[model samples]
Target: MISHRAPDSLSTWRAAILIAVIALLVSCGKPPPKEISTLDKIRTTGVITLGIRETSVPFSYLDDAQQQAGYAWEIANRVATAVKRDLKLDTLAIHTFVVTPQTRIPLVANQTVDLECSSTTHDRERERQVGFSSSFYLTGPRMLVRRDSPVRDWSDLRGKRAVVSSGTTAELALRKLDRERGLDIEIMLAKDIGENFMTVETGRAAASVQDDVILYSNIARARDPSAWQVVGAPLMREAYACMLRKGDVPFKRLVDATIAEMARSGELMQLYTKYFASSLAVKGGVRIDQPLSDDMRELLRQPNDRID
Candidate 1:
């Protein structure tokens, strides 16, 4: 049988072939990967996939018929309308995708959804991975406790455990507070807001830390409002925005512009009032004042500012 390797000449030939293969791979023109913008995708598909929360109460939740409707849902529908107009589509279909706190970012990044109008916390760390719309809502961290619980403020939880939703900005804010303030409070994470608040409900944890908006909305959903109380001073101010994939500059611009237009025309305030304000005050005794954050003012002036 002929020798598999023809001595040094065969070895040289194999080495050359390997180098050529690598060069071919390096120089391969594979369409430079498909980098489609949200706007482009909308135009191409004639559909907008909006990611919403499944159990976020007034933000985005299922009704009796299990259809999506809430403040976030309405806002997303408005944006979808603007998107359809921008793309000059005959009638762009709006698709709803339920997302939890943990899956929102991944869904946006993977293009499973075009825009995420869920109750997502806007932060610098998250901005690295996904784009955020102009801040339409400004909120802070708050604690929910039993009506009879002695914990009235943020400082009362020295040794007690504070429950928060897992993989959420509330948990991150609590951890940061723990390190910065040297607070010895044990931070516990629940799978969701309902679970986090359940800790307080069952008296298993001293308190539950979460977004003030979410807390108020959840309280409104509760069958017994007198059983639990949202306690303590605001721990941290966080902004909420519509999230999209990062590097979609065109998409980001369009989203920003849409928000600015809404703010300029006072439509955003109306949405907030219609969904969040009166409901909270009348039902939960929480009055969310207007122009809560600087973003509100800036958005009023320039609604399309790039938050990321």
Candidate 2:
């Protein structure tokens, strides 16, 4: 026969039992975080929601009637076609969601969009929140100014205000520039590129900072391309990639493969040629739509490459 424990000992033992029960309940109460399934979701949905910028022309933007059109849109269409094949569906609705750099990942996390085809940079901080595709286009950061603006370089922004896109790498670049040169310039953020250009055009802001390629593309697509100018030198080299939810390996792999296939087939080149080759009206000089540079060309060559 076992003897009974002292009162204090019994109390301690009882508390231990209570703690274990509480722990068990806590473990069982909450459900695990939802796992991201790359294949099944696409198969069942029969649609791919693509995140695109509404006004970033030559990459992803609206046409005259405000319908989606551009190089990035073309890429999205091809990816949608492949997804349709996987689902055995004849036609999949290519739903387009307008997103900014700041909102892109949050939308993906919430399943508001299947993939982001907008101009997005892959950074360690961003990777912690979402997965990134291989670099689709690589370029350097540059500035946009009116034809008669006084700003010659990034340093010229000191004691001046520069317009930047809200929640973009451009804004971050400007911040870094501010710190390095100890410039006291103020940075203003615009809701979109259209407004950003307007900031400089109206003389409200001295210049606009952006990716060199995007600034060039914008100038190429402008109504009167000669009215504005892309000024200054490249401040930083950037590699733009498509963004997806973190941990969705299969979907990322499939997209990488599709991009590679397009590159190999020369379809990517054709798409770029179709949309970005024409130069829009401008002021200072004729802004020729340059051919795909070496960095972008290399990006096109790497099919199925993943970003770690």
Top-TM-score candidate index = 1
Tens-digit per-residue lDDT, 1-308, candidate 1: 99866688978989999999999998685545456688877888888999987666566776555667666677778788888887888989888787877788989988999999867777888878788886666677888777888899877887789899887777877888888878799888898777877776777889889887767666666668668677776677676788988888877777777777787788877776666656432333433332244644555455542433
Candidate 2 residues lying further than 4 Å off, grouped into runs, are 1-34, 87-93, 98-103, 217-224, 279-291, 303-308
User: lDDT of each structure?
Assistant: 0.75, 0.75
Clashing residue pairs in all predictions, respectively, total 2, 9
Q: Which digits, one per residue and each the tens of the lDDT, describe model 2 over residues 108-183?
A: 8888888887667777778877887766666676888777778888788889998888877778888998988999
Q: Local error of candidate 1 at 207, Å?
A: 1.2
Worst 10 residues of 1 by lDDT: 281-290
Error of 1 at 188 (Å): 2.4
